[model samples]
Target: MSNGQGMATEGEVQEGLTVEEIAFIHGHLHDNVGELILKAGKFKGLDVKKLAAQIQSRQKALKKLPEWSTNEKLIFPPALSVEQCSSEATAHYKASIVSGDRLIDITGGMGIDCYYMSRSFTDTHYFEQQPEVASTAAYNFTQLGATRIHVHAGESLHALHDGLNADWLYADPARRDANKEKVVRLADCTPDVAGNAALLLNAAPHILIKTSPLLDIDLASKELQKLKEVHVIGYEQECKELLFVLDREMPEQDFKIKVRMIDAAGQPIHELDFDREEERSAVVSYAKPLGYLYEPHAAVLKAGAFKTLCTRFNVQKLAMHSQLYTSEEYVNDFPGRSFRIVAVCKPDIREISQHIPGDKANITARNFPAKPEELRKKWKLKDGGDHYLFATTLADQSKVVIVCVKPI
Candidate 1:
């Protein structure tokens, strides 16, 4: 498989291949083994048509591997998985700056989001700390005919500190710890939120920070002064990451705080509105679960509209467990599905150990101050069960347990 210009050699076919060759392989190879061989044989120029035929021939004898797909239908780079790409795309789309002429992405991982957002801006600057990633991005941009884009390899904060100006700054901070552990909170990462925020906000009028799905929105919002928007994204009702936007210049009237959960097609699955003047306390309380239970969408939870949600759904709060609410009437128009509470307990370890006498149990602890894994371990519970035990805290500072099942 050699071309005229130093194309096909044994080493090239066996080990070294250019990115263009890899892209060809990705498009033609159907199986993981074929993909691996093509990746290994990178230096050589593999025939795309031949590889496709080879893949078709090999498929007859090979066992099928698990195929991975996402509800978001996001297309990812070969280096990243579909889930990661979908998540990054959703966050970038939601945090997009429509008013910006020039945009700067401080941490462009695979150039997926950068490619999508660059369409709205006149010019785009993408910075990647890793040399390989930066090179890949440069090649990809050139191949895509994106002449107005520049890919730089260096530290983002240092580059920003050197005086880069843009209408918007987007950053995805490294959330990995020193021990190579994944951390969810702002305090967990290197150059923490404050440090990154200082550099990012200094470069642009608006900065968008993408955070973990497990992060505490209240805590994150409290940490950033100019935080104007918080979004909790979801794909097909499954909660994903939380996005925070901080604006340097305030609008004439503060934009109403919005909580939006979007689907794979970039449609709003659920939305909740909040203002600076809205109260965070629990609102109206209805009688115990009568016909249905309404769980607010992620955006609603991020907005901390416990009272507003309850009022909107005509539900009652289950004390202080802000994660859940109860109602008697069936509100078909509610964003979240309705569930029925079958039982409630005090969540005493002794009571739980004594009352539950089964080989399998489904344990979920929310706002009750106990970790789910710890509770599951302590209770010796297993999965694949119909019952859901909710260990949550009440407004009275009391820990309680509620057993629930999906409503018919």
Candidate 2:
């Protein structure tokens, strides 16, 4: 249950990386990491462990942080930090909204967000409790050509508790409790955001907190006072982070939640802003599978925008409980996958066998009794093909299987 303190051990890293180590890492940048690991015994001068970390992390950065990944001199943390830290896409999204004279990021793990967020501010503070992580961020910030960030090593809340007002206060607190357990609630996290929001507001009027995507938005809004907006961010259709913005002067009546869907390049594909009333009164019409099936993107689904999806796209809900949608006319700009109805039938073993001619076909389920694996076993369908099967509940609460072709 440990949340894992993903930092490098003492002696594993130095104050400054050596020239030879940097050269060794860059020389093997394009080489296969697995083959290099197999031949590590042959390299007598290079520290294979550090080289492996550089290679592994660089491979991830190439895709995760394309702009920063090319810098050969940047110091990368252990695998845990590399995997857990915010991707360049999410960091850029944070940068787009924040603008001010000064800003501070308290839980600066790999400093990815700090580096990007500094773009919108004149001065920035990067704080981390771990000295090694702080030091690494300091060095990489310079190597990556960042000019504004001031790296501060220590507990962030204590460092800024002196009542210095900044334009923006940002934090992505460690989502683990003292017992090393993974914490889902904001109060259970280190720095206890729920308890310290008042204390933090004393330093800045506006605060942005990043939390787990699994956190319930409705519950968070109730627990966090002065909460202004909840942003559900997604990259390549996969939901990544839940960003909460709180303002000191904004009243609850003026509060609004915004959901943004972004692609891999941090471009917004779709966005919606709604009040609590809109969510409560939003009505969705349900019908059976029509000419086409529209599946909302992951971010919209996480934001619980079922009614909004139907209203925006001019689609009908397949069932009240089912999140799937359908429309008679093709909606070209639908956020998620769109499928043309090839056929529809009850999910009988013999019917499904007849619907899908091939043994291999992609399968999915929505508001259905059985899992994908179970359906595959029952129908003896393999896992690929031009065809796709969706097992969903109709508006009448009847179990039905949908056979669909590629997007219209």
**Per-model TM values vs. the true structure:** 0.65, 0.90
Could you tell me which 10 consecutive residues in candidate 2 have the lowest summed lDDT? 1-10
Mark the regions of model 2 whose C-alpha exceeds 4 Å error after superposition.
1-16, 27-39, 178-182, 349-357
The lDDT per prediction is: 0.60, 0.80
- Candidate 2 colliding pairs: none
- Write down the lDDT that model 2 would get: 0.80
In candidate 2 the C-alpha lDDT for residue 224 amounts to 86
Candidate 1 clashes: the total is: 6
Q: How much is 193 displaced in model 2, in angstroms?
A: 1.8
Q: Output the worst ten-in-a-row residue range by lDDT, candidate 1.
A: 64-73
- Which number leads on TM-score? 2
Among these predictions, the greatest lDDT belongs to 2
Query: Listing every candidate in turn, what is its Cα RMSD in Å to the true structure after a full C-alpha superposition?
Result: 8.8, 4.6
